[model samples]
Target: MTVTYLLVDGENIDATLGTSILGRRPTPEERPRWDRLLSFARDTWGQPANGLFFLNASNGLPMTFVQALRALGYTPVPLSGTEDQKVVDIAIQRTLDAIADRDDDVMLVSHDGDFLESVEGLLDGERRVGLIAFDEFRNTGFTPLKHRGLQFFDLEHDTHAFNSTLPRLRIIPIEDFDPAQFL
Candidate 1:
């Protein structure tokens, strides 16, 4: 049977949402619905999806969020390290390396470019690889992966993982602009 490893980098997603997209902390209505993301992953490949949420718990474990992740069928991978180390990224990168040896597919839910190398390694005809993020905020470095067959799905649009539409700034097509409506 086919299976997909849905790896989530919560920090990267949250940073992009608050800093690049929203310009402020996301309200409850704007927060992503984790369950919806998991469902989307399962539906994408029509197979069972194992969601793994990575967090930098060097400060302390957020029990509430960890519990929520468990309730939603995601394994919470909290990591710790030295002050300068990026624990979550390290763990996710290592996990990706390990997944490269397996036949199961991968869906990474982060806009960070740090995983580009690992992602590229997984495109060797052994399994399907996918990236999930907001189109406007995703790193341009990942663009080339599309030509190599790495599918991309928008977290909000494709996954519908939020209750309300998020306010994001994206370039609009000149043809899409209606001056009369604004006037």
Candidate 2:
């Protein structure tokens, strides 16, 4: 059997889902069910041998979230540093490099353009690499990947299954809310 690996860039994915679908950064209480997400990916890719999630430690991600990832059978790799320096990206690159020689399929879950070269290199080396992200989100940075004939999985398109466990966003009545409190 061909081993498959799911690699997630947590920060990028959460930000995309927040801005593109949730209209805000997802709160800890509003976090997506990691199990469902993994299941969806696995089902799409025919059962991955391993799943890894890369998160930036400096973002103040809760330990509970890390535990949740672990519970879903994902290895959470948390890197420490500012977002601008691309520490998470480097970690992902290093991890991919370490496993590049293996004859396994990889699913990369990020929309950042920074991974373009890495993906290209993997494809050039005859490895199967797919991308997963919100295709509707602006600046998804997937043109190069698409041009190279890589497969893509849109998270927004799979909202029915992926969002099944999340609580609905409650809307407050206009009369019950006061907008002048801040002013």
TM-score against truth, every candidate:
0.92, 0.74
| lDDT of model number 2 | 0.70
Q: For residue 153, give model 1's deviation from the true position in Å.
A: 0.6
Model 1 whole-model lDDT (C-alpha atoms): 0.90
For candidate 1, lDDT tens digit of each residue in 62-172? 999999999999999999999999999999999999998788999999998999999999999768899999988788999998988899888887899988867766555
For model 2 the TM-score comes to 0.74
Error (Å) of candidate 2 at residue 162 is 2.9
* Predicted structure 1: clash tally: 0
- Candidate 2 residues lying further than 4 Å off, grouped into runs, are 28-30, 59-61, 82-84, 138-141, 159-161, 164-183
